[model samples]
Target chain A: MVDVQAHLPVLIVTVPLIGGILTIATGRGWKPWAWATFLTGTVFYFTIRLMMQVLASKTGMVSYELGNWPRQWGIEYRVDALNAFILLIVGGVGFITTIYAKLSVEKEIPADRVNFFYAVWVLAITGLLGITVTGDAFNVYVLLEISSLTVYALIAMGKDMHRGALTASLRYLILGSVGASFILLGIGYLMMITGTLNMQDMHDRLMSVPGILESRTVLVAFAFLLAGLGMKMAMFPLHMWLPRAYTYAPSAVSALLAATATKVGVYMAFRFLFTIFGVGFSFGMMPSGLVLLLCASAGILVTGVTAIRQTNLKRMLAYSSVGQLGYIVLGFALANLHGIAGSVAHIFNHAVMKGGMFMALGAVVYRTGRCDIRSVRGLGKQMPLTLAAFTVGGLGLIGFPLTAGFISKWYLVQGCLERPGGWPLAAVVLIGSLLAVVYTWRVVEAAYFQEPDPGTPPVEEAPLMMLIPMWTLIGASIYFGINATFTGHIALTAARSLLGGAP
Target chain B: MTGVLGIYNYWIYVILMMIGLYGVIAKPNLIKQAIALGLFQTGIFLYYISMAVIDGGTAPVWTTVQDGAQKFQGPYDNPLPHVLILTAIVVSVSVLAVALALIINIKRRYGTIEADEIEAMDIADRLAEFHAGAAADAVDEAAAEGHGLEHAHGGHHHG
Candidate 1:
């Protein structure tokens, strides 16, 4: 008999991989195949949740060695609280996005491309899950590139079929590829030094290497990795590709990439910083923490200010995503237990909140055929249910009470307050939230207060398939906000594990 | 002197990287920008290959004819970096192909590949539309003023 629990992590990744292949092979004639792919994602989520319970119950980590090889020589897929928490976020959002995609895609994408879209969608999810669940450094880069390549293709197939979509996707592809190369080079350099690609072995080797502490090569490697990953996360100065891509991509693709892609990048950044480099060396021995802090602070301020000025609703949300990523990076830069915990929680919280918001926007675009502020005028009277979902999502973005966004910001503020020089960081977080309120309110104002144009026809609500998933995310956002213990407990435990602790 | 030559190779790679980056940043043409990106990627490949070079190292292979003897006499150049860079090269080309396709599409839709031109066109369209609305409203005001003047004159005649 197979040890099912031991095989769960690989299954989490493999199920999606096989489903992607099946989706492509089945072609457009089999709509059920796409649903099966979606069902696989849902089942994968349940399996991860079960694994989380197992970890919580045993208070231990699960490490699966590929091909029955030893830890140092062979590839390993390790899952602890940190990845389990992230897996839930990725899988959960993926499920909701897939469900939302069913109807939203029918309206936006051509029937001929529908099956291919689902195939690429599942492949992207598989790549992301693979990146999260793996223990090999080089594998992470490969998987990152895989997901990024598929995303570029998916985004380029937007409704406009204009060069803008293609151009934006191209820009993202170029930048993303360059970033992945840098990460790979850095990993190669690490391998040269340690003679091992296994993360834990590299960590142990790096501890005792003489003169590596002062080696310029190592420092350059770190810099390259940081810059590359920063681009992937759409960190401030490197965020030029995001707005156009989000604006031009198909609505469902936008929702999925917005919700989960950058979060995966953030996860990789954390993995490299805390696991491979070791926190002591990353923060105490190098200037990485301070550098990340400065960049993140700039990202928060600049992106937040810029987001408020955007007239297009989807582009505005994309910029808000940049600002939100800054918050997560800022939390990571704090390098304390509370700070790390907050960062982890925000990963889950932001994914849900942003996913829901983007889905609502997708709903509006589906109904009105425009995502511009002026186009959505009098939407409250026309598409009241869709507008309600948008309102909930907007409130969440503002960190309003009884919303998931509040939990993230609260923990982040608390985390910053606990540090010695954290007052400034705390102030930046507060200012960012206030700016979020401004931009989110801008959309809400246009949706509710503006009068409808005289000759325009009344718009109907989004289809049931779209509305259900959007509201489910919105409701979950509110539910988690009220009872954060579930998210909070896992985040705390994950943070501890990431910091290399038993508890 | 050989060691110095090795160091000089790295400096060349650095310069290449900087040039490529400058092209990516400064060029306004999208195709040019893509080429620059390609250049940037090639520069990294140069760095990787340079780092893997060894002193009089032979290619990594084996000769079965020589009773399973290794091919290299001296320290063999690291094949790992070469293998890794091969994968990277493929990925870079894939991206370039896709980007080029997009650039072609952009040219077809926008009729130009210059970033600035696209921005200018989009801005001009908006500006012209805005001013056209204002001009129509101005014409309506002038007509209303003329009609009011005629009505006043007619009223005076009737009195």
Candidate 2:
């Protein structure tokens, strides 16, 4: 029999896929919720087990070859410290969000589709987790398609909330399918040159062969991959679909997606640049780093200002997420150890902070039946625990000292300063966060300072079931803020792994 | 003549793909956009299928001794692209299905399949919401326990 650890790699993905079918089988009411929660919890347990084993190993990578097939022909799952860190985010966020999904989902979706929602939610998580764990080139494309398809279904479930949800889902489906197709075509081009689908194998083979990097096919692949992934992650200009998709999706689904989906795009961009293309050649061949830098800077400036003007809370948060994504890309473009490490840290921090904000907003929507900023007036008095959780998340977004956002922006600026003539980029960073303050203040001011409408009736706080998950994420963001050594140490280790062979 | 004929597979795929892109971006009707998406996807499928072709190769299937055939010695067309295309085809079909389902919902809710008209409706809805929110704020101030509330007068001032 295969070693138990070897099974962990496949199990992390399979359990969720199987759980999804069983989730659908259980059908409506409490059964689907219970099934999905239990299944996601089990997946979380498996991910921790595999990650601990990888962390303890000297190599910091866990690889499993599928079906005992030959190396080049078979599919492989190779999880390094880089992806291991992502695994924890996906699993931890998946489990925590599932905990809060029941009440929020029941309110937002039609009764008949509740079970279907959970099934599709689990499927989307499976696709995301699969993308993280796989070590094959083509497999990433397949999993991307899988996740994109399921996400469209989940977003469409929010049609009951607004008719706009239907159009949003349609736009996302169209763009997402095109993006996935481009990635597939890029993978085809890579396969033509490398003759192997396995990522690690391709890396080694590409390095050994000289002059291949200069070929027209490789350049074409690079462009296609970057543009395709850029569109998926809502990179700077190509981010038109993102705000509406998040604004209109069921709160729980959007929380999970905003926490993980685009982050997976960030991961692919890193993998392609650092691992597949070999960092030296990728930056040297094309001024990719400079291009990314300018693009990311534009996203931060434009989206940050736009977020200040949104009256709908969810739409504002969606625009803010686009800005946050810009920060992660900026870290990569800086191409320093600290910069990449900061990006990794922000991945975890953003998942918690953003997820916390969306979850709290969902709780607000649950009670009041509205998502407009006016609905939140005097919410601080009515829902102290929920608003307090949101306050912490909002402060984190503004990068106040002693929060996760500060730590991320700190290292990212430090990464910039270390580069020659980098002060200008650092100024851009400060400018983005300054605009963040204005937008975050809008929500806090509305919730705490403004008076509640007299026509509105008294309201109770959100149920304990929702508060617990929301508080957990808020708490984690703070904990990371205080004790950086935990996420910080892992981030450094992962960054080092991607940057080189020796620490 | 040979040069032109050899690359025609690529030429057709490119033309179909552009046509599909036009349908998706330029078409106003939602159903038309969905059909365009299908056309775009079919172009990609053909592109992949063309990549699998070989000048003088047979099918990749292997023969058993009982079959008494030895065609395996010849160059076989690449089976991997074909396999990949099959998966892509499945993904594309499912996406199209979801798109159609969404269009039906849009038609029911918005009462129109034209993109511009739906956007116009959304803008109108938002204006109503803005006024409603303004009215709510005025009313809230008037209703609060302690005051005549200067803003309370503004509620009836919407005219």
Candidate 3:
């Protein structure tokens, strides 16, 4: 192995953690942002390298040992095709968010504390990377907290500017900590049963443990993991804190967290369910599938309706995020290859689309200083650059043809049809898409057709620094939609790998 | 009897978890909720620490021995769970710090740590914004009408 290549996994995460400290050392100002952006960019490069190396590997896995200890005794990073794809999404978004944060934070937050902003930002990015790359089961909990704690600070930072941001941040903190505690509880149960913390070793041991099907310990562990991840991902009923938190947070942080945080939670669900517990235990040994289906369907229908009632664009999009998660969960609920494929595809597509859209909204806030729908009236004529980006992203979010979202929903529909008596499932998907159209159209109509606001002063385009990053994500959303060769292949590989071996 | 006694520690964790969960769900004060969150996390910490102990094992430190001396060997308690719990405890502490910080900021902004009052404030703010928007629209319409009338008067005078 090349000398640099051998250190890729740890470097991919450590680069940002160190950068956060370096940024703190530099003190608050332009220097912190400069350090953060450069560090995030470096991590982004390493993340892509790790992805390529994993893809190129004959075994499709990259294992990096920490401190050179043996496998079971060491903290190891196991990179597979599944997490590699997630790395691309997380690292890529972190990089763009860093670039966008400079101008966005300058507008929304005070200048003196900008260093603190980038410091926490780097920590958040590293936390996410750590969560994705770690192979040890217990390491996931630590990494999960790394991101969750940073996220709480980031959200609360919005309090200085927005009135309710602190309350929203507090609610998220309480709920998020609860979620983390539950996950730790679940991990404890798994450890007691298997006597190992290494994920692969745990899987091996779990297979040998008798009475697993009827084991209440195993069942309770499963329940805890489900509820814990549900809280983290804001699944259906456990989603009250999300809309307020997203709406009240600074726009740049919103884009970053929206694109990556819950995504890590979703990835954990896949990792623990299929990779650790065995698919049969998660699906067949229990009635998890039916329960997931019911919750996902309700999440789709209910959140879709709720999103329509929101006046603040950010909250609307936030509720829309909940509804979108429903689709991803529905994929896993189906427990088929196409279903898993759709789930992974939406993970990529939705991240790009939401990143682009939220960043555009952030840009709009930078230029206009308002978030209500009315403020965007005739913004198409004034802030055309940001508005145009928002339009494409919104279109993709609505599952329009030639958009990333359509491909995801298409595969998801195919997944539904692959099951017996599946038309009702398919119908719900269609209705959700139509509901998305309504929300997207609400924005489009307000921007393009509503009478131009006479109360607000005219505004120019957002700065080039912000526009460039936003457009890059927007372009990727379309680029992936048009050419799914790379993403589609990876998604299929990941799905097959998850199901390759059965009990 | 030994098996039953062995299970009591697990029951303690369960009860602690339930108390934390109830506090998180039912507590009205934001700071209390944050503390409840910490307590909930502590339950997990307790579970992990308990898992580290083995029935007849010593602490996982190495003891020096003379060369080739025949001695009884016993297993050491698993150190990994202790290490894991230490990390989790750190996480739990940091979570508390962030939660308290957020509550402080919220109290500063809203002047109350009560969840209900804060929620009430939020509703009032939204209502206020709604009315403000309506008033702004009304004023804009009347100004437009007044401008149109002025243009008409100017045309008639020119004619």
Output the number of the lDDT-best candidate: 2
Candidate 2: where are CA atoms >4 Å away? A1-3, A501-503, B1-5, B63-71, B139-159
Q: How do the residues A278-360 of candidate 3 rate in per-residue lDDT, one tens digit apiece? A: 77778877788888888889999999888888778988889989888999999878889898899999999999899888998
What are the per-model C-alpha RMSD values against the true structure?
7.4, 4.0, 5.8
By summed lDDT, the worst window of 10 consecutive residues in model 2 chain A runs over A494-503
| Residue B4 of model 3, lDDT score | 62
Give the DockQ of candidate 2.
0.34
Better candidate by lDDT, 1 or 3: 3
TM-score of each: 0.89, 0.95, 0.94
For model 1, residues B1-159, the per-residue Cα lDDT tens digits are 666674786788778878888888899988888888888888878887877887788777764556765554557897767876887888788778878877887787678989888777655543543443334334444443344323422221110
lDDT per residue (tens digit) for residues A1-503 in model 1: 97766677777777777778678666674483466446556656665665566566565667789888897767798777778777777887888788888777777777787888888888888888889888888779878877998898889888252335766787788788778878876886787677778887787777788777577767777888888888898887888889889977888888899888999999988888888888887887888888888888899889889999876788889999998999999988888878888898888888888888899888887776556676577888888888888888878877888998888888888889998978999999989988988988887787799876544458887889888888888889899999999888878877777677222
After superposing candidate 1, which stretches have Cα over 4 Å from the reference?
A1-4, A29-36, A39-43, A46-50, A53-59, A159-163, A501-503, B7-12, B53-60, B65-77, B122-159
Q: Give the Cα error of residue A385 in candidate 3, in Å.
A: 2.0
Relative to the unseen true structure, what is the C-alpha lDDT of residue A338 in candidate 1, on a scale of 0 to 100?
Answer: 82
Judging by DockQ, tell me the better candidate of 2 and 3.
2
**lDDT (tens digit, per residue) of candidate 2 on A259-282:** 999999888887877888877766
- Residue A447 of model 3, lDDT score: 89
For residue A374, model 3's alpha carbon misses the true position, in angstroms, by 0.3
List per-prediction Cα lDDT, in the order shown. 0.79, 0.85, 0.83
